[model samples]
Target chain A: MKTKIFGAATLWLLACGPAAAESITWWVPNWDEEAARELVASYEEANPGYDVEIVITTWDTMAQRILTAMSGNNPPDLITELQSRIVLYASRDMLTDVTDWFDRDLAREDFIDSALATGTFDGRLYAVPFRHDGSGLIYNRDMFEDAGLDPEQPPRTWEEFVSFGEALTVEQNNVITQYGTAWPFGNLDNAVVRYLQLLYDGGGTFFNADRTGVELDSPAAIDAMQRLTDTILTNGIAPRSSLEIDNTGLRELFANERIAMFKGGPFDVDPLVDAGMNIGTATLPGTGGIGTTTVDGFSVLVPGRANNPEAAWQFAAFIAQPDSQTRLTATFPANRIAAENERFSAPLLQPFLAQLDEGVPKPSAEGWGEMQRILFDHMQSILLGSATVEDAMMSANEEINALF
Target chain B: MKRSTPRRGFLARLRTDKDGEWAPFVLPALFVSVLLTVYPVGSLVWTSLTNIGPDGVQFVGFANYVELFQMPRFARILGNTIVWTLLTTLGALILGCVAAVALEHRAVVLPGVWRAILLLPWIVPQVASATTWKWFYSSEFGMLNHMLMTVGIIDAPVAWLSSALVVLPAVALVQIWSTFPFVMLMVSAGLQSVDESVLEAARLSGAGPWQEFRDIVVPSLRGVLFIVSLVIVVWALNSFTIIWVITQGGPAGRSSIFSIYVYESFRNFDLHRSAAASVVLLVASLIFAIAYMARLRRQS
Candidate 1:
């Protein structure tokens, strides 16, 4: 009788013990970790059956870590990868198709078209866009005031942009104490993005209509390339040391008053303000025609190695919701409804939203990685005066075409 | 008794004689070597012959090698690698020997402090050194350019890292600074083995300082110099951190070496091409090793 009672008691104890909660690992870029953690905490609170682990990664190391993890058969359940890498990841089948999640669980029509298009590859959703950024001009109002240019009326045409820059530049005995603008000709990622914007602004595209071939050597594109490089070499408005700075480096120079202006987005404003600077925003100047800029962003994706796809998808869907995006610290939300929230309509972020209205997503073609690499080399050649615009364009087009 | 002979043969196979005793001692080392070096190298060889792409892995054989050879940048990359390795190795050795001899001289004071200060570059972390050097090499605001400008050396800032003709030497200067301490330490040790009396006799025989150094010191340090140079050549050839952190093999790849090409390939998910590049690099390193070992054998 006592043994029977004891067995019943043991069974009762076993039943009372806590069940193992399903856990999913998330790798996010360093910038969005705090927002991600808050969202994850809310997710765990709302869904008691799961736990989450967030690993912070940077852009420089994200690709490498993801590659290693995928190949090692130990990939995180979800990762936040940049938009440029989505096509590569999707083409390689490294990411899980989240089409059904988007279709069944969310209102797909509410997403910003460019943002959704960036995450879609070959008619399947491999990732969900979170925060999006596009290139625009951020100018120093104080420098504009000093140069006797109207601070309220930023340059809208390429000619005025160059003239304004030349006016704002400060030189002391041939050493530039304050550069008119810091164009990032050094780093490939920034340089290529700027180049793409210029190419698009000049009414040129990287590929033929069917996307079967590259057309980087087109006259319009070459003219665009020549004009951009000429701003540095021919006009002498840009610092020769411009090659020493990346996008962030340009922002730093602007913050420190070493540069008067540069290409950036709404996200750059707050940081520069926090760093104690007076900055203004404007649409990127156009080449006397319709303006265009390339959209760039980060996306949340579930790897094929996800241990808990259901739970991972749940997190992805939750994070893409308007509520979660509204809490993000920087970069405009990818959700149109969330981005339209009253707070984002502030004067500081409004220009970025306007710019995003006309922004085009990066090319989703398979050969984009190789194309970018070759373009970077050729762009540097032109910027450094080693190769002519015609020569660089021809060479880059030939190499990029060979890849296709 | 007849069956005992078979057992005795097995025991003799495991004998600890002069030749066979090393087997037991080296077994663990061999196991580690196979695990770390031999196994990875074998995997690299296998991977080089396979294309692990979007379609998954398949044997493609020499296709990757053919493509790599036909790559337009291959010749330039090879030339850059050779120039970088040779210049960095030679520059470090010359600078190190001079510093070592000067520090070892009797006229020098605070030798210990000087030695510690000289070794600071070697002791500091590579990432730190690279970051510091990046700041130092900055064109408009860098201390190097700033100092030169302050002294009225030039009216304009020199584009140390941007100009193609100047970038190779600029990067080599950083490599030399970071690496000379290794050569210094090695040469300092070699100097300890030099006979002071031999130097004294040379000096007493009406030999000036230059003659004493040429006649007595140079011959004594030849073997040390040779070994240091060979090691440094291999190290500089394989160097990635300094160049990667500083220039990222850019300003149009004027400073790119073989390792950067391999790394870029790997980063781009071109595993077959990366593996093929790795194999070629391994072969080049092996040739250096073979040449070094053959020279050492001849000297012995």
Candidate 2:
């Protein structure tokens, strides 16, 4: 009896060992690194032997470095990526298909199945999300009040947005001193993300369900891209200078009070608050019949040569649980129970939590990575007033079509 | 062994009889030349033929060449590259030569101070210089517009980098400004070697100042000019950092040149395109070098 008891205890400890013993490399992008660091510290304290080594890089270099590392012998044990990108890596055979891992350790029933679907491509789970992402209109309360617009009433519809954006647009000496609203088209991902949200809100398809071709040249999309382009060039609500700024650059400008209303993710608010802005946040504007937001988050994965896949799965499952997901949740908690908790109902956090139903992962196309550059050059041309909307979209469509 | 010694004597008997000692020096140089130049170039030529796109490479047998010639982007890049190299070289050469001639007289308040200041640009790191220029072009809060507005030169800050019409000139200005010091140093060294007696002889003849410079000083500096031009062309072709840091070959590929194009092709995981682009540049440089050498021979 004593021998059997001792053997059982050893098995239990070995099974529970990842929470205790393995050091994993966790690649973190430009999100809240400080919060991620704090999240890991508590984990280290709870689990004695295991610690995560955080490899930090900016957004531009992150994708390249991750791809470079995957080709080498040892890849990161855990990677944080947007929901849209989870499938791209899995398709490349760079990730572990965690279908059985999720079955034995976790389940879609335990987390928000829709959000988890982003990490699942073709019935195999590739990533487990750690945080949430949803974009909305973040405006300057002071600017709105000063401009004599209602601080409580942000734009609710597309038509309203155009007029609202125009009201805040201030000019001096025939040059716009302040921009009303702007979407930065500098980085390929952000442009795609924001555009995806716009298209979805406008009742459009990013691609056909099979992901065979682009739906960009469709009449609805032409209207959306054209109107968006018009908001800057023809409407004069946004400045042409916006094309020069990337996401971070745009956020910095917002923090510095150069832009009046910023349409960005929940991660943007804290920085503005830190910069001492009287900021107001809300759900991103909607159109047609549906209100849409892009649901994106990072996830942890087990690379090949994981010292123990079982242990990695246990930790991944444990983190997906409400206990861990709630604590680690910055924008979206994958756990439905954790997402509804009052603890996540803070000012900007409320929008991300509230917008969960509207959130959909941006489509993951096979050659979507190359398609981004094709999109960027054309988007830039449109923004810089180099080409008409039709011509620019046509060039973009042709280039994207060639990617196959 | 005795016959070997006599072979050198016989080789002297073969050609250039008095200069048999050159055989030893020339033979080692020939061996070194084959090892250094021939092997790497042979390898480069081999790789240039293969389609080595970002992921990995496969042998494609001139497919990279065919693709390169067909791409309109490559033609645009090639044209921009020619303009960039010519403008930078000619601008620097003219400015450098004039400064060297002027400074030779020691006319500045403190000639040593002025010379030290001139060398400052050359000593500055390329990245640091590029970064400074990038800030100066920044639209949000650049000092260029502050100065312009202060003087009432323009009502608003001109978008220097974002406009295609202005970007190439802006990039060329950076290159000419940063590299002129190098030309100055080279031309200064060459100018010091010009025979003062030749200047006196030209004046003694019917030649005026312009004729004197054209006939005497220029001919004397021919070797240095040829070398500087050759190096400048290669430098300009291969340079990626300044343009990469500043315009990023942007304002709609207006400032895009061969190096930036090659680097971007590699950046986007299109390695075959990069290799092909690099081979094109290598061949262009070789053609320039050969032309320069022939010119040197003819001038001599």
Candidate 3:
């Protein structure tokens, strides 16, 4: 009888013991740490027997660290990475396909087309974008008024942009006290993006249809290059410092009233507003109508070696939901519904939203980084007056083609 | 009458002998060095001879090196590296020697305070000082341009970091600024050991200041100068932060150096190319290191 009783107790313990909780690790950028922590807390509260860990990454180390982590034996279950970088990992087989989950759990029509396209490689979804943005014409309204231009009316065409720039420029004693505008030619990525925007707006594709070579030698490309360089060299409206400042530096110049206008994204809105600057936003001026901007953003992905892919997908899907996206994204959320929220509906963001419809996703080819670097070098040559626009474009085109 | 003593084994002797006593303590460090430094360097060398890609690493001995050398930009980058290294080393050495000599003069007041002030550039963090200097060199809003224009030195701002013709020297100037203080400190330490009696004897013999400095001071500081030059040369070769933060070796690779090329290659996921460049840099640095070791051996 004692042996039978002990056996019964052991059976009861075996049946009733707490199950092991599944743990998932998620890596997020430092900017999203707080929101991610809050989301993790709520997720843990909503679901028992599951815990999610958060690791913070920064801009300076994100690319190399992510590549290293994904290639290692143990990788985070989930990661928030730049959308442009998702295809690189996907091409390497370092990511897990989530097409089924995306199709079943999310409404396809509710997300921005370009944002969703960044995560799709060879007809498979590997990531879910949360933030999406493109550049718009961000100008100081007061500067426009002070320069005798209507504050409400921003430039609509490329010619108008140059003429307006010349009007807004303030020169005293041969010193540009208040320059018209600037480009982010100092940074490789920024410089490339700006050039790409022009290239696309002028009807040039960075890569050929089959993605094996470049079209930078096309007439449209040369025209775009000429126009961009002429802003400083020919128009003489922009300061020479355009070659020394990135997007952030350009925004600072705008804030200090040293410049009147520049191209920037929605993320620039809040800071400029908080700084008490009367800013206006408009779609980027094009050769014809609204110009096309390069749409880039952040997305959540699951590593191929994740131990808890199901839980990771679950959390990723949760984050993809409209409300969660709204809370997490500093810019416009990828979900159309979430973007309708009052916070993103401010007048400052409308132009960016409108511009998104005409946006093309940034290129994510395997060798795009190197190609971009090559293009950046030649673009600098054009800006520095060391090479003609045609020569620079042709050289960039040949070099980029040689990469394939 | 002879007494026989038992011969100690190696292990037994290691515990008692003064020289051998350090063996046990050093084993851990030596093992760590082999594990950390030796292993990584071996891996770098092996990686340099292959093409690493998404599929797998393929052994392509000398292929990566050949490709790197065949590229036109490689020649330009090599030239930039040599120029940058020589320019920075010589500039720092001359400035450091001058500051050291000037501070040692009896006519200089509060030499310690002046030394501290001069060391400020070295004491400030590299990233912080480089960033500040970048702003100071800015063409439009830079304080340097502002001051120069205000003083009627120039009518327009010079694109210090943007002009290809001027970028290398501009970045080299910042490199010299931050490193000269180190040279000064080393030279100052070397100057302290100069025999006061010898200097006085030269003075008594009616040697002018320039003559004494040219003949006595320079000769005595030869060893220190050599080591300092080697150190500065190695530093300039390995430099990344200053140039990266300032110009990013840009305006069409005008300031491109080997280190920047390596980093850019790595960031672009061309690991094989990056490793190859790194191996080239390692070999270049090793030459100086070997020279330094040889000098040390000869001196000993």
Candidate 4:
């Protein structure tokens, strides 16, 4: 019996060793612990021969960590990365060119054109998008009903939005009791991106057709920023104080019913639901009959130097499978067919799915950090009364032009 | 003063110290210091001259330095660093001196209790303190607004952290509270050494309390004060955790200091620029360090 036990233990140790097994290091930005663990278990069950070591990372550290790892000889086989980081890694010739690996459906019909286009630069594909997220307006159903507006009908136009927002603003004794909306403004620079989305939705493009010029000097872009700022600061609907609160604090207030509506994404969904809000979700109201919002999420990229590039690609492609994606992530898959199915869609996400056309990709550029800085600086100037809408947009254009 | 070196030849000394195990005793620590401190600093200076980032780096000489001066964001960050350092140090200094002077007075009651209470802020972990301040600064249902409004001093709740003005002061307050204890401890030590005979003599000779402080106390405590100032300068210059946790230099990038800016560059995958920014911060700190050393030399 002792001999049998010793032999079994030795066999287990041999199987566990890296030399014996084709172990792939998969890096992911940290998320729900239990859910991630469950998904990993399912994957391990499915792929019996292959072992997946899921390396969890934080958002703040992800970019630097991945880059440092890649610079080293023994980098991870596969990495789930941010779109921002993907562009950086791809620019450096660190990622494996995935042109041959991409399936026909992934190229032609399964994936949306713009979403697929974001992962590729110039001519070669460098990454595959894992999950997608962007912004939308989450309103209080009770607050809308109390304000005498139909909760069922959400705002579709900029005019209707302003009017509804005005009706919801509650003030007494020169103090706001309930704010109409908390469009987070100032300091944090998240507000700047939201302003860009507003600008985009207003038929304003930050760049020209060739992705070379700075056209943010246009009147439409100027008007979009001005309207957003005025609505928050000058106008009584959205509070200027919302500018002070960071994203987390603002979300908390929105959850706690202090704010009637919030500009947020799916990450805020479950939290709001847990907080007991009668949530009425809708796409961002637009000026030119089309809505736009900023998209933020991870991409999968294989490093250039891999012990097993084929195995890495296989594992990556496996996770990105439509069925696998639907099972794992809270996000709608890049696969268009997966999106059309109610089987893949969760209950709270029905509204986001309905307004799928509103999901426009944010502009891709080599020096995105610099571009974001210019965009953020102008947006703040608009809030601080240092610059008018036109001036701010023009400033952004000039700065970005100098950069890109 | 105690060394006995009577007519010993160099050969005799060499023989006396020959094959000494002191090499084994001190070499490990010396080697560690060389590895940890010397090597990294040398590399840091080298990195500052290079375009080190996610992509491969190449030697850029002083281009990073030239760009540092040219970048408006760098200027903003520099100005922020100066203001934040000055404000935090000045605030910490003033409050600490006052508390120390107050504690020096024997007429003050419950000195032990007061000392314990004062140390409370410093005793808490920095992360915990920062997180608490973040909650305190929250606009909706924040402890600050709640307490202020409940006192009936203000009819409406003010957003304590959203406005640029309020956030700076609130962050400063947290730092002030956390840091004053160190200064107080130092000052109190310095104060005890202030000769009681000298104070009594001054009082007997018609020196007022102000005169005693300005003349006797000031001159006597100058050494401690100088040391304290140096420490505060370094702390204030690098102090980012409290502000980072509380505001993260936001509400329109109003509070982006040098340290925070370095972090931003790193976050944005521009660590080459971050390294360059770090050199600028290092130079600023080096100036203070040199000044502190000069003061120490002057005292000696």
Tell me, by TM-score, which candidate is best: 3
RMSD of each: 7.9, 6.7, 7.0, 6.8
User: DockQ: which candidate is best?
Assistant: 3
Per-candidate TM equals 0.90, 0.79, 0.94, 0.87
Q: Tens-digit lDDT track for model 4 on A274-336?
A: 777889888777774447776656667889876677667766665555555565556666656
What is the C-alpha DockQ of each candidate? 0.43, 0.21, 0.73, 0.42
Candidate 3 lDDT for residue B156:
81
Q: What TM-score does each prediction get for chain A alone?
A: 0.89, 0.86, 0.94, 0.87
**Residue range A75-180, candidate 3, lDDT tens digits:** 9999999999999899889999999977756666778999999898998999999999999999999999999999899999888999999999998877779988
Across all models, the iRMS values in order are 1.6, 3.0, 0.8, 2.7
Tens digits of per-residue lDDT for model 3 on B122-173? 8898899988888899899999999998999998889998998999999999
Model 1 RMSD, rounded to 1 decimal: 7.9
| Ranking of models by lDDT | 3, 1, 4, 2
Per-residue lDDT of model 1, residues A227-281, tens digit only: 8888788887887766666776677778878877788977788888887788888
Q: What are the lDDT scores of the predictions, listed in order?
A: 0.82, 0.73, 0.89, 0.74
Q: What RMSD value applies to candidate 2?
A: 6.7
lDDT for position A23 in model 1: 86
Candidate 2 residue B247 C-alpha distance from true site, Å: 4.0
Task: Select the stronger candidate by DockQ from 1 and 4.
Answer: 1
